[model samples]
Target: MQEAFSQTKNASAVKNNYDRVAWFYDPLSRIVFRNAQIQAQQALIPYIPEHANILIAGGGTGGILEAIADQYPAGLRITYVEISEKMIRKAEKRFTGKNTVTFVHSAIEDYAAKSHFDVVITAFLFDNFTQEKADRIFQKLDKLLQPDGKWLFTDFHIDKKSSRSWKTWLLKSMYLFFKFFSEVEASQLPDTTSLFKKAGYHAIFTAFWYRKFIHSSIYQKP
Candidate 1:
């Protein structure tokens, strides 16, 4: 994945776009998606072990870090990775004196993991890629997990059966907004559930927030 990300055509563009919005990301994100975001994080908290080695890929602005720290148990080693330097700096501010959390400023594809992590968290991260890229990236992420490890994922999903027309409009509007400001590669949400199943990951738990527009699930790697 590191190699693939290094070769990505829009890596720098994406990084720059996020950097441009780092200052406003926290506040805007809170106003727009805080409820669902918090709910998703809370759902995954119970699955994380006390002494686990965890990877937080594309954890923008460190909202997840703050949540984990509030209820964090001792002996857990967390490596938080974000591609935007400014975003990571904000995260760094939240954990100023904490030794258990290590921050890495790099794209997930370029990050070098010394060993497989017991748990991997990718909250609201996968929505930025196209289906094909998301599939490749998921494969790479799966390789970074321990054999029995679980992946805690949260992102937007547009369910045709369950979603209303207005919900679809809202999702599209949000995507267009991000695409202009963040250079988001995908104009629509990827079919993540299908990709996960194809990769041999089974959902151990799942939840929906905001009328099922936002989906959260924990998939275990076999």
Candidate 2:
């Protein structure tokens, strides 16, 4: 989750940024969010049907691969999409199960779908983008999902009602760190809940972790 990225036009910079931090991304995340990121992801895994086709976009360090593989030791295929070569290599060695996985080394924007996916997992992906980039990415992925497909989205959530709170300061500090470290474009998290609702994806389940700072939700394409 600590991996930073940018829009496609600046893919090289983002790739370099992610690669530079690939060694420390997971450790930094654990230091900051502890197990919240992991918990939020696992909360949505039960919704994935057996033999499902899954796409993991921006899969940092590929830690979740082990979890998904554990959930379905067989009868599952994963398309792991990432921009960083170093991260891809790390992810390649992370999976230790029977599920078939195909690693795609490309930005999500540059990723061409060979087949529609039954499940799309974009954990902590959107928080790195501005509203425009996030919307563009969302629209693209929205089209690649099969009907009745499940979209698992997990990211930081900040309440607009509370303009001045610890979460706001913490998020601001995080953005500053990411901006300095990875040239990330986002200064704040997007309004993800509204974005999903606008896309007409029906929410199947929602959960929060790390004191509600992190949100995980599964939506179905009707």
lDDT of 1 by residue, 1-222 (tens): 011122233444553248878888777766977677778777888888777889999888887776776676456788888887777777777742342777777777777777789999998888888878788878889899998899999988777774557778877887888777777888777888887788788899999887777788999988
Clashing residue pairs in candidate 2 are none
Colliding residue pairs in candidate 1: 2-109
**In candidate 2, how many Å is residue 145 off?**
0.4
Q: What clash count goes with each model? A: 1, 0
What are the Cα lDDT values of the candidates?
Answer: 0.77, 0.83
Give the candidate number with the greatest lDDT: 2
Across residues 76-133, which tens digit of lDDT does each residue of candidate 2 receive? 8888888777788898887547787888778897888889999999999999888898
Candidate 1's C-alpha runs over 4 A off are 1-12, 15-17, 96-99, 162-164
Cα lDDT, model 1, residue 71: 70
TM-scores of all predicted structures: 0.88, 0.92
Question: Judged by lDDT against the true structure, how good is candidate 1?
Answer: 0.77
